[model samples]
Target: MKELIEVLVERKQKNASPLPYHGWVGPCTQVSLLYDGFRLGDASNYDSVKSFAQLMWPDGHPRFCKSMHTMATQIEELNKLIWLMIIDSYGLGEKWESVMINYKMLVQFMKYMAPPPGVYERGLFAHTDKPVSTIICDDQVLGLEVEVKDGQWIKLSLSPSSFCFVVGDPLRAWSNGRLKAVNHRIMMSGDNGRYSIAAFVIPIEGTIIKAPKELIDEQHPQLYKDFDFMEFFLFAFSDPAKHIDSGEQLHAFASLSPPISN
Candidate 1:
Protein backbone atom coordinates (compact mmCIF):
# COMPACT_ATOMS: atom_id res chain seq x y z
CA MET A 1 0.00 0.00 0.00
CA LYS A 2 2.79 2.41 0.88
CA GLU A 3 4.61 1.68 -2.37
CA LEU A 4 1.41 2.21 -4.40
CA ILE A 5 0.78 5.55 -2.74
CA GLU A 6 4.34 6.68 -3.33
CA VAL A 7 4.15 5.79 -7.02
CA LEU A 8 0.79 7.55 -7.46
CA VAL A 9 1.98 10.67 -5.69
CA GLU A 10 5.07 10.78 -7.85
CA ARG A 11 3.00 10.37 -10.98
CA LYS A 12 0.61 13.14 -9.95
CA GLN A 13 3.48 15.50 -9.26
CA LYS A 14 5.02 14.88 -12.68
CA ASN A 15 1.80 14.98 -14.68
CA ALA A 16 -0.23 18.15 -14.95
CA SER A 17 -2.55 17.04 -17.75
CA PRO A 18 -6.25 16.80 -16.92
CA LEU A 19 -7.60 13.31 -16.36
CA PRO A 20 -10.38 12.01 -18.61
CA TYR A 21 -13.85 11.29 -17.27
CA HIS A 22 -15.67 8.04 -18.00
CA GLY A 23 -19.43 7.75 -17.88
CA TRP A 24 -21.27 4.82 -16.34
CA VAL A 25 -24.82 4.09 -15.27
CA GLY A 26 -24.07 5.76 -11.94
CA PRO A 27 -21.65 8.18 -10.31
CA CYS A 28 -19.08 5.59 -9.26
CA THR A 29 -17.44 5.48 -12.67
CA GLN A 30 -18.33 8.99 -13.75
CA VAL A 31 -14.97 10.65 -13.12
CA SER A 32 -11.69 8.82 -13.18
CA LEU A 33 -10.15 11.83 -11.51
CA LEU A 34 -12.16 14.19 -9.32
CA TYR A 35 -10.15 17.35 -8.71
CA ASP A 36 -11.74 20.12 -6.71
CA GLY A 37 -8.93 20.83 -4.29
CA PHE A 38 -7.83 17.21 -3.76
CA ARG A 39 -7.46 14.28 -6.12
CA LEU A 40 -9.70 11.20 -6.29
CA GLY A 41 -9.20 8.41 -8.82
CA ASP A 42 -11.56 5.51 -9.40
CA ALA A 43 -11.13 2.14 -11.12
CA SER A 44 -14.28 0.13 -11.37
CA ASN A 45 -15.04 -3.19 -13.11
CA TYR A 46 -12.38 -5.57 -14.38
CA ASP A 47 -11.50 -3.68 -17.56
CA SER A 48 -11.01 -0.40 -15.68
CA VAL A 49 -8.35 -1.89 -13.41
CA LYS A 50 -5.66 -1.97 -16.09
CA SER A 51 -7.00 1.06 -17.93
CA PHE A 52 -6.86 3.30 -14.86
CA ALA A 53 -3.46 1.98 -13.89
CA GLN A 54 -2.12 2.83 -17.33
CA LEU A 55 -3.75 6.25 -17.21
CA MET A 56 -2.08 7.06 -13.91
CA TRP A 57 1.28 5.65 -14.87
CA PRO A 58 1.66 6.11 -18.63
CA ASP A 59 4.94 4.22 -18.80
CA GLY A 60 3.43 1.39 -16.77
CA HIS A 61 4.29 0.39 -13.18
CA PRO A 62 4.17 -3.42 -13.12
CA ARG A 63 4.49 -3.62 -9.35
CA PHE A 64 1.75 -1.08 -8.79
CA CYS A 65 -0.61 -2.84 -11.16
CA LYS A 66 0.09 -6.21 -9.56
CA SER A 67 -0.47 -4.80 -6.08
CA MET A 68 -3.79 -3.20 -7.07
CA HIS A 69 -5.02 -6.45 -8.66
CA THR A 70 -4.07 -8.46 -5.59
CA MET A 71 -5.65 -5.97 -3.23
CA ALA A 72 -8.85 -5.93 -5.29
CA THR A 73 -9.14 -9.72 -5.10
CA GLN A 74 -8.68 -9.69 -1.34
CA ILE A 75 -11.22 -6.90 -0.91
CA GLU A 76 -13.73 -8.72 -3.10
CA GLU A 77 -13.44 -11.81 -0.93
CA LEU A 78 -13.86 -9.75 2.22
CA ASN A 79 -16.98 -8.08 0.80
CA LYS A 80 -18.54 -11.49 0.19
CA LEU A 81 -17.79 -12.68 3.72
CA ILE A 82 -19.20 -9.50 5.25
CA TRP A 83 -22.42 -9.79 3.23
CA LEU A 84 -22.79 -13.43 4.18
CA MET A 85 -22.73 -12.54 7.86
CA ILE A 86 -25.20 -9.69 7.31
CA ILE A 87 -27.71 -11.80 5.38
CA ASP A 88 -27.50 -14.64 7.90
CA SER A 89 -28.18 -12.23 10.71
CA TYR A 90 -31.32 -11.10 8.88
CA GLY A 91 -32.39 -14.72 8.16
CA LEU A 92 -31.73 -14.24 4.43
CA GLY A 93 -28.89 -16.75 4.22
CA GLU A 94 -30.51 -18.66 1.38
CA LYS A 95 -30.81 -15.51 -0.68
CA TRP A 96 -27.21 -14.44 -0.36
CA GLU A 97 -26.04 -15.71 -3.73
CA SER A 98 -29.01 -14.20 -5.54
CA VAL A 99 -28.59 -10.90 -3.77
CA MET A 100 -24.94 -10.70 -4.74
CA ILE A 101 -25.40 -11.76 -8.35
CA ASN A 102 -25.91 -8.23 -9.62
CA TYR A 103 -23.26 -6.60 -7.45
CA LYS A 104 -19.67 -5.63 -8.28
CA MET A 105 -16.79 -4.00 -6.47
CA LEU A 106 -15.28 -0.60 -7.21
CA VAL A 107 -11.83 0.46 -6.02
CA GLN A 108 -11.05 4.13 -5.41
CA PHE A 109 -7.74 5.78 -4.59
CA MET A 110 -7.98 9.18 -2.92
CA LYS A 111 -5.28 11.73 -2.18
CA TYR A 112 -6.17 14.73 -0.06
CA MET A 113 -3.67 17.56 -0.39
CA ALA A 114 -2.36 19.26 2.72
CA PRO A 115 -4.27 22.31 3.84
CA PRO A 116 -2.84 25.81 3.59
CA PRO A 117 -1.00 27.27 6.56
CA GLY A 118 -3.27 27.60 9.60
CA VAL A 119 -6.35 26.64 7.59
CA TYR A 120 -8.33 23.40 7.52
CA GLU A 121 -10.26 22.56 4.35
CA ARG A 122 -12.93 20.01 3.68
CA GLY A 123 -11.29 17.41 1.50
CA LEU A 124 -14.60 15.67 0.90
CA PHE A 125 -18.14 16.60 1.82
CA ALA A 126 -20.31 14.68 4.29
CA HIS A 127 -22.47 12.16 2.43
CA THR A 128 -23.56 8.54 2.75
CA ASP A 129 -22.24 6.08 0.19
CA LYS A 130 -24.67 4.91 -2.47
CA PRO A 131 -23.42 1.35 -2.49
CA VAL A 132 -24.04 -1.61 -0.20
CA SER A 133 -20.83 -1.26 1.84
CA THR A 134 -17.44 0.40 1.65
CA ILE A 135 -14.16 -0.69 3.23
CA ILE A 136 -11.57 2.04 3.66
CA CYS A 137 -7.84 1.56 4.25
CA ASP A 138 -6.12 4.79 5.12
CA ASP A 139 -2.60 5.92 5.85
CA GLN A 140 -1.45 7.30 9.21
CA VAL A 141 -3.40 10.53 8.74
CA LEU A 142 -6.23 11.57 11.05
CA GLY A 143 -8.81 13.30 8.84
CA LEU A 144 -11.69 10.87 8.37
CA GLU A 145 -14.74 11.74 10.46
CA VAL A 146 -18.06 9.98 11.00
CA GLU A 147 -21.32 11.42 12.28
CA VAL A 148 -22.93 9.26 14.94
CA LYS A 149 -26.61 8.90 15.90
CA ASP A 150 -26.28 11.65 18.54
CA GLY A 151 -25.48 14.25 15.82
CA GLN A 152 -21.86 14.53 16.88
CA TRP A 153 -18.84 14.06 14.65
CA ILE A 154 -15.99 11.80 15.71
CA LYS A 155 -12.63 12.00 14.02
CA LEU A 156 -11.02 8.66 13.27
CA SER A 157 -7.37 8.12 14.08
CA LEU A 158 -6.49 4.91 12.28
CA SER A 159 -3.31 2.93 11.80
CA PRO A 160 -2.08 2.25 8.26
CA SER A 161 -3.04 -1.44 8.56
CA SER A 162 -6.52 -0.95 9.99
CA PHE A 163 -9.64 -1.11 7.81
CA CYS A 164 -12.93 0.69 8.49
CA PHE A 165 -16.17 -0.92 7.32
CA VAL A 166 -19.02 1.50 6.64
CA VAL A 167 -22.62 0.70 5.79
CA GLY A 168 -24.26 2.45 2.80
CA ASP A 169 -27.76 3.46 1.76
CA PRO A 170 -28.44 0.24 -0.15
CA LEU A 171 -27.52 -1.91 2.86
CA ARG A 172 -29.72 0.18 5.09
CA ALA A 173 -32.68 -0.32 2.75
CA TRP A 174 -31.97 -4.00 2.20
CA SER A 175 -32.02 -4.57 5.94
CA ASN A 176 -35.27 -2.65 6.28
CA GLY A 177 -33.40 0.14 8.07
CA ARG A 178 -31.99 -2.31 10.63
CA LEU A 179 -28.55 -1.00 9.72
CA LYS A 180 -27.97 2.73 9.41
CA ALA A 181 -25.67 4.04 6.72
CA VAL A 182 -22.79 6.12 7.99
CA ASN A 183 -22.40 9.79 7.11
CA HIS A 184 -18.71 10.55 6.70
CA ARG A 185 -16.42 13.30 5.45
CA ILE A 186 -12.75 14.03 5.13
CA MET A 187 -11.28 17.11 6.81
CA MET A 188 -7.73 17.85 5.71
CA SER A 189 -5.11 19.62 7.79
CA GLY A 190 -1.46 19.31 8.77
CA ASP A 191 1.54 19.39 6.40
CA ASN A 192 1.32 15.88 4.93
CA GLY A 193 -1.10 14.67 2.29
CA ARG A 194 -3.53 11.87 3.22
CA TYR A 195 -3.98 8.82 0.99
CA SER A 196 -6.64 6.13 1.26
CA ILE A 197 -8.00 3.21 -0.75
CA ALA A 198 -11.69 2.31 -0.67
CA ALA A 199 -13.39 -0.82 -1.94
CA PHE A 200 -17.11 -0.26 -2.59
CA VAL A 201 -19.64 -3.06 -3.09
CA ILE A 202 -22.01 -1.54 -5.62
CA PRO A 203 -24.91 -2.94 -7.57
CA ILE A 204 -24.94 -3.32 -11.35
CA GLU A 205 -27.03 -1.18 -13.72
CA GLY A 206 -30.52 -2.60 -13.31
CA THR A 207 -30.52 -4.32 -9.96
CA ILE A 208 -33.81 -3.84 -8.10
CA ILE A 209 -33.05 -3.25 -4.44
CA LYS A 210 -35.69 -4.17 -1.87
CA ALA A 211 -35.75 -5.55 1.63
CA PRO A 212 -36.60 -9.20 2.03
CA LYS A 213 -39.86 -10.28 3.69
CA GLU A 214 -38.00 -11.69 6.69
CA LEU A 215 -36.65 -8.25 7.52
CA ILE A 216 -40.05 -6.52 7.38
CA ASP A 217 -42.74 -7.20 10.00
CA GLU A 218 -45.40 -5.25 11.83
CA GLN A 219 -42.86 -4.30 14.49
CA HIS A 220 -40.29 -3.46 11.79
CA PRO A 221 -42.20 -1.86 8.96
CA GLN A 222 -40.80 -1.56 5.47
CA LEU A 223 -38.95 1.71 5.26
CA TYR A 224 -38.20 1.64 1.53
CA LYS A 225 -40.08 0.45 -1.49
CA ASP A 226 -38.68 -1.62 -4.31
CA PHE A 227 -36.53 0.71 -6.43
CA ASP A 228 -33.92 0.37 -9.13
CA PHE A 229 -30.51 0.83 -7.61
CA MET A 230 -29.15 2.56 -10.69
CA GLU A 231 -32.11 4.96 -10.81
CA PHE A 232 -31.58 6.02 -7.22
CA PHE A 233 -27.86 6.28 -7.76
CA LEU A 234 -28.38 8.60 -10.71
CA PHE A 235 -31.03 10.63 -8.90
CA ALA A 236 -28.71 11.17 -5.96
CA PHE A 237 -26.17 12.77 -8.27
CA SER A 238 -28.63 14.73 -10.42
CA ASP A 239 -30.87 16.26 -7.77
CA PRO A 240 -29.38 19.46 -6.37
CA ALA A 241 -31.13 19.40 -3.01
CA LYS A 242 -30.59 15.67 -2.47
CA HIS A 243 -26.88 16.12 -3.08
CA ILE A 244 -26.63 18.05 0.20
CA ASP A 245 -27.76 15.15 2.39
CA SER A 246 -27.79 11.48 1.50
CA GLY A 247 -30.50 10.74 4.04
CA GLU A 248 -32.74 13.04 2.06
CA GLN A 249 -31.71 11.32 -1.16
CA LEU A 250 -32.89 7.94 0.09
CA HIS A 251 -36.12 9.37 1.38
CA ALA A 252 -36.86 11.18 -1.85
CA PHE A 253 -35.98 8.26 -4.07
CA ALA A 254 -37.41 5.17 -2.39
CA SER A 255 -39.02 5.71 1.00
CA LEU A 256 -42.37 3.95 1.41
CA SER A 257 -45.52 5.81 2.39
CA PRO A 258 -46.74 5.11 5.90
CA PRO A 259 -50.19 3.58 6.27
CA ILE A 260 -52.96 5.80 7.58
CA SER A 261 -54.37 4.92 11.00
CA ASN A 262 -57.98 5.17 12.24
Candidate 2:
Protein backbone atom coordinates (compact mmCIF):
# COMPACT_ATOMS: atom_id res chain seq x y z
CA MET A 1 0.00 0.00 0.00
CA LYS A 2 2.83 2.38 0.81
CA GLU A 3 4.34 1.70 -2.58
CA LEU A 4 1.05 2.41 -4.32
CA ILE A 5 0.69 5.70 -2.44
CA GLU A 6 4.15 6.78 -3.43
CA VAL A 7 3.42 5.98 -7.07
CA LEU A 8 0.22 8.06 -7.05
CA VAL A 9 1.88 11.04 -5.38
CA GLU A 10 4.65 10.94 -7.96
CA ARG A 11 2.17 10.77 -10.81
CA LYS A 12 0.26 13.73 -9.38
CA GLN A 13 3.42 15.74 -9.11
CA LYS A 14 4.42 14.97 -12.68
CA ASN A 15 1.06 15.14 -14.43
CA ALA A 16 -1.42 16.96 -12.25
CA SER A 17 -4.48 18.58 -13.82
CA PRO A 18 -6.61 21.57 -12.80
CA LEU A 19 -9.93 19.81 -13.31
CA PRO A 20 -11.39 18.86 -9.95
CA TYR A 21 -13.34 15.83 -11.14
CA HIS A 22 -10.80 13.94 -13.23
CA GLY A 23 -10.20 10.74 -11.31
CA TRP A 24 -6.51 10.40 -12.03
CA VAL A 25 -4.94 13.82 -11.60
CA GLY A 26 -7.28 16.30 -10.02
CA PRO A 27 -8.60 17.34 -6.61
CA CYS A 28 -9.89 13.84 -5.78
CA THR A 29 -7.16 11.92 -7.51
CA GLN A 30 -7.90 8.24 -7.28
CA VAL A 31 -7.38 5.24 -9.53
CA SER A 32 -10.26 2.96 -10.34
CA LEU A 33 -9.72 -0.56 -11.71
CA LEU A 34 -12.87 -2.05 -13.17
CA TYR A 35 -13.60 -5.77 -13.40
CA ASP A 36 -16.04 -8.13 -15.20
CA GLY A 37 -19.48 -6.68 -15.92
CA PHE A 38 -21.88 -5.66 -18.73
CA ARG A 39 -19.53 -2.88 -19.86
CA LEU A 40 -17.09 -5.56 -21.01
CA GLY A 41 -19.47 -7.07 -23.52
CA ASP A 42 -17.00 -9.78 -24.47
CA ALA A 43 -13.61 -11.04 -23.48
CA SER A 44 -12.15 -9.40 -26.56
CA ASN A 45 -12.79 -5.88 -25.20
CA TYR A 46 -9.06 -5.40 -24.91
CA ASP A 47 -9.16 -1.66 -24.49
CA SER A 48 -11.26 -1.99 -21.35
CA VAL A 49 -8.64 -4.12 -19.63
CA LYS A 50 -5.85 -1.54 -19.78
CA SER A 51 -4.43 -0.42 -16.46
CA PHE A 52 -5.10 3.08 -15.11
CA ALA A 53 -1.43 3.95 -15.17
CA GLN A 54 -1.28 2.81 -18.78
CA LEU A 55 -4.19 5.11 -19.61
CA MET A 56 -2.62 8.16 -17.98
CA TRP A 57 1.03 7.51 -18.73
CA PRO A 58 0.47 5.48 -21.88
CA ASP A 59 4.12 5.90 -22.82
CA GLY A 60 5.11 3.35 -20.16
CA HIS A 61 3.95 1.52 -17.06
CA PRO A 62 3.95 3.41 -13.76
CA ARG A 63 6.13 1.89 -11.05
CA PHE A 64 3.35 -0.01 -9.27
CA CYS A 65 0.93 -0.69 -12.11
CA LYS A 66 1.35 -4.42 -11.72
CA SER A 67 1.07 -4.27 -7.95
CA MET A 68 -2.02 -2.07 -8.02
CA HIS A 69 -3.72 -4.34 -10.54
CA THR A 70 -2.86 -7.38 -8.45
CA MET A 71 -4.20 -5.71 -5.31
CA ALA A 72 -7.41 -4.68 -7.09
CA THR A 73 -8.02 -8.22 -8.32
CA GLN A 74 -7.51 -9.61 -4.83
CA ILE A 75 -10.01 -7.15 -3.39
CA GLU A 76 -12.50 -7.92 -6.17
CA GLU A 77 -12.41 -11.63 -5.33
CA LEU A 78 -12.80 -10.90 -1.66
CA ASN A 79 -15.85 -8.76 -2.43
CA LYS A 80 -17.39 -11.64 -4.36
CA LEU A 81 -16.93 -13.96 -1.40
CA ILE A 82 -18.48 -11.47 0.98
CA TRP A 83 -21.41 -10.88 -1.38
CA LEU A 84 -22.07 -14.61 -1.60
CA MET A 85 -22.00 -14.94 2.16
CA ILE A 86 -24.49 -12.10 2.59
CA ILE A 87 -26.84 -13.71 0.07
CA ASP A 88 -26.60 -17.13 1.69
CA SER A 89 -27.20 -15.70 5.12
CA TYR A 90 -30.39 -14.14 3.79
CA GLY A 91 -31.39 -17.64 2.53
CA LEU A 92 -32.03 -16.37 -0.98
CA GLY A 93 -31.92 -20.06 -2.08
CA GLU A 94 -31.61 -20.91 -5.77
CA LYS A 95 -32.22 -17.25 -6.53
CA TRP A 96 -28.61 -16.52 -5.69
CA GLU A 97 -27.01 -17.43 -9.00
CA SER A 98 -29.57 -15.64 -11.15
CA VAL A 99 -30.12 -12.59 -8.99
CA MET A 100 -27.08 -10.45 -9.62
CA ILE A 101 -25.49 -12.35 -12.51
CA ASN A 102 -24.67 -9.17 -14.39
CA TYR A 103 -23.14 -7.19 -11.52
CA LYS A 104 -19.99 -5.13 -12.25
CA MET A 105 -17.34 -4.05 -9.77
CA LEU A 106 -14.29 -1.80 -9.45
CA VAL A 107 -11.72 -1.08 -6.80
CA GLN A 108 -10.79 2.51 -5.94
CA PHE A 109 -7.38 3.31 -4.50
CA MET A 110 -7.79 6.78 -3.02
CA LYS A 111 -5.12 9.14 -1.77
CA TYR A 112 -6.53 12.02 0.26
CA MET A 113 -3.47 13.91 1.30
CA ALA A 114 -3.61 16.43 4.08
CA PRO A 115 -4.57 19.62 2.33
CA PRO A 116 -2.81 22.84 3.29
CA PRO A 117 -4.54 24.20 6.39
CA GLY A 118 -7.71 26.23 5.62
CA VAL A 119 -7.56 25.39 1.92
CA TYR A 120 -9.88 22.37 2.07
CA GLU A 121 -11.77 21.17 5.11
CA ARG A 122 -13.27 18.05 3.68
CA GLY A 123 -11.79 15.44 1.41
CA LEU A 124 -14.85 13.58 0.11
CA PHE A 125 -18.41 14.79 0.55
CA ALA A 126 -21.24 12.86 2.15
CA HIS A 127 -22.61 10.22 -0.18
CA THR A 128 -23.79 6.65 -0.23
CA ASP A 129 -21.98 3.96 -2.15
CA LYS A 130 -23.79 3.11 -5.39
CA PRO A 131 -22.63 -0.50 -5.38
CA VAL A 132 -24.39 -3.38 -3.70
CA SER A 133 -21.70 -3.48 -1.05
CA THR A 134 -18.47 -1.67 -0.29
CA ILE A 135 -15.48 -2.93 1.69
CA ILE A 136 -13.04 -0.32 2.95
CA CYS A 137 -9.53 -0.39 4.37
CA ASP A 138 -9.14 2.96 6.14
CA ASP A 139 -5.41 2.52 6.79
CA GLN A 140 -5.59 3.79 10.37
CA VAL A 141 -7.23 7.09 9.40
CA LEU A 142 -9.56 9.01 11.68
CA GLY A 143 -11.58 10.91 9.11
CA LEU A 144 -14.32 8.54 8.08
CA GLU A 145 -17.77 9.35 9.40
CA VAL A 146 -21.23 7.82 8.98
CA GLU A 147 -24.62 9.54 9.24
CA VAL A 148 -27.41 7.40 10.57
CA LYS A 149 -31.15 7.84 10.00
CA ASP A 150 -31.40 10.33 12.82
CA GLY A 151 -28.88 12.63 11.15
CA GLN A 152 -26.29 12.01 13.83
CA TRP A 153 -22.70 11.70 12.71
CA ILE A 154 -20.60 8.79 13.93
CA LYS A 155 -16.85 8.81 13.59
CA LEU A 156 -15.14 5.59 12.66
CA SER A 157 -11.80 4.86 14.26
CA LEU A 158 -10.34 2.20 12.03
CA SER A 159 -7.41 -0.03 12.83
CA PRO A 160 -4.72 -0.23 10.18
CA SER A 161 -5.59 -3.82 9.35
CA SER A 162 -9.35 -3.84 9.98
CA PHE A 163 -11.95 -3.81 7.23
CA CYS A 164 -15.22 -1.87 7.24
CA PHE A 165 -18.11 -3.41 5.37
CA VAL A 166 -20.74 -0.92 4.27
CA VAL A 167 -24.15 -1.55 2.76
CA GLY A 168 -24.67 0.46 -0.40
CA ASP A 169 -27.67 1.92 -2.23
CA PRO A 170 -28.12 -1.07 -4.52
CA LEU A 171 -28.30 -3.49 -1.62
CA ARG A 172 -30.84 -1.33 0.12
CA ALA A 173 -32.98 -1.37 -3.02
CA TRP A 174 -32.35 -5.05 -3.61
CA SER A 175 -33.29 -5.94 -0.08
CA ASN A 176 -36.60 -4.04 -0.45
CA GLY A 177 -36.14 -1.57 2.37
CA ARG A 178 -34.83 -4.24 4.75
CA LEU A 179 -31.49 -2.49 4.71
CA LYS A 180 -30.41 1.13 4.53
CA ALA A 181 -27.46 2.43 2.58
CA VAL A 182 -25.06 4.17 4.89
CA ASN A 183 -24.29 7.82 4.24
CA HIS A 184 -20.63 8.48 4.77
CA ARG A 185 -18.01 11.17 4.25
CA ILE A 186 -14.26 11.72 4.47
CA MET A 187 -13.00 14.77 6.35
CA MET A 188 -9.52 16.19 6.16
CA SER A 189 -7.56 15.60 9.37
CA GLY A 190 -5.25 18.54 8.74
CA ASP A 191 -2.35 16.64 10.28
CA ASN A 192 -1.33 13.66 8.12
CA GLY A 193 -2.42 12.18 4.83
CA ARG A 194 -4.75 9.21 4.42
CA TYR A 195 -4.57 6.24 2.06
CA SER A 196 -7.58 3.96 1.77
CA ILE A 197 -8.75 1.36 -0.69
CA ALA A 198 -12.43 0.70 -1.43
CA ALA A 199 -14.06 -2.00 -3.50
CA PHE A 200 -17.44 -1.07 -4.99
CA VAL A 201 -19.46 -4.15 -5.95
CA ILE A 202 -22.18 -3.04 -8.37
CA PRO A 203 -24.74 -4.76 -10.56
CA ILE A 204 -24.54 -4.91 -14.33
CA GLU A 205 -26.24 -2.34 -16.50
CA GLY A 206 -29.80 -3.12 -17.66
CA THR A 207 -30.32 -5.63 -14.91
CA ILE A 208 -33.70 -5.16 -13.17
CA ILE A 209 -33.06 -4.37 -9.50
CA LYS A 210 -35.80 -4.98 -6.96
CA ALA A 211 -36.67 -7.04 -3.94
CA PRO A 212 -37.12 -10.77 -4.13
CA LYS A 213 -40.63 -12.22 -3.74
CA GLU A 214 -39.64 -13.88 -0.49
CA LEU A 215 -38.85 -10.54 1.04
CA ILE A 216 -42.00 -8.86 -0.17
CA ASP A 217 -45.32 -9.61 1.47
CA GLU A 218 -48.42 -8.02 2.98
CA GLN A 219 -46.55 -6.69 5.98
CA HIS A 220 -43.36 -6.10 4.05
CA PRO A 221 -44.73 -4.71 0.83
CA GLN A 222 -42.32 -3.77 -1.89
CA LEU A 223 -40.81 -0.45 -0.95
CA TYR A 224 -39.23 0.43 -4.26
CA LYS A 225 -39.98 0.06 -7.92
CA ASP A 226 -38.06 -2.30 -10.15
CA PHE A 227 -35.74 -0.30 -12.38
CA ASP A 228 -32.96 -0.81 -14.87
CA PHE A 229 -29.50 -0.77 -13.44
CA MET A 230 -28.24 1.19 -16.43
CA GLU A 231 -30.77 3.95 -15.80
CA PHE A 232 -29.76 4.15 -12.16
CA PHE A 233 -26.12 4.19 -13.20
CA LEU A 234 -26.67 7.21 -15.39
CA PHE A 235 -28.63 8.96 -12.65
CA ALA A 236 -25.84 8.28 -10.19
CA PHE A 237 -23.17 9.81 -12.36
CA SER A 238 -25.33 12.57 -13.74
CA ASP A 239 -23.88 14.97 -11.20
CA PRO A 240 -20.57 13.99 -9.73
CA ALA A 241 -20.94 16.70 -7.11
CA LYS A 242 -24.50 15.89 -6.09
CA HIS A 243 -25.13 14.40 -2.66
CA ILE A 244 -28.05 11.98 -2.94
CA ASP A 245 -30.52 11.05 -0.29
CA SER A 246 -30.59 7.41 -1.30
CA GLY A 247 -34.22 6.48 -0.56
CA GLU A 248 -35.79 9.79 -1.46
CA GLN A 249 -33.98 10.00 -4.75
CA LEU A 250 -34.73 6.41 -5.62
CA HIS A 251 -38.41 6.99 -4.98
CA ALA A 252 -38.57 8.74 -8.31
CA PHE A 253 -38.97 5.29 -9.80
CA ALA A 254 -41.35 4.03 -7.19
CA SER A 255 -44.25 1.89 -8.37
CA LEU A 256 -47.81 2.76 -7.44
CA SER A 257 -48.14 2.30 -3.71
CA PRO A 258 -51.24 1.24 -1.74
CA PRO A 259 -53.49 4.24 -1.31
CA ILE A 260 -54.17 5.43 2.19
CA SER A 261 -57.72 4.86 3.44
CA ASN A 262 -59.87 7.97 3.79
Largest TM-score belongs to which candidate?
1
Candidate 2 to native Cα RMSD, angstroms: 6.4
The clash count of every prediction, one per candidate, is 0, 1
Which TM-score value belongs to model 2? 0.75
lDDT of 1 at 225: 85
What are the runs in model 1 whose C-alpha is more than 4 Å off? Answer: 1-47, 240-244, 259-262
Error of 1 at 4 (Å): 7.8
C-alpha lDDT (0 to 100) for residue 123 of candidate 2? 74
Task: Tell me which residue pairs clash in candidate 1.
Answer: none
Which candidate number would show the highest lDDT if scored against the true structure? 1
lDDT of 2 by residue, 1-262 (tens): 4543445444545433232222443353231111101111111123333434453454545444555556556667777777777678778756787664465555556767776656536777677776667778867867789997788988899766778889877677787777777888887755777777776665655678877777777777777777876576567656632454544556544443761111
Reference-based lDDT, each prediction: 0.68, 0.61
How well does each candidate superpose onto the true structure, as a TM-score? Answer: 0.80, 0.75
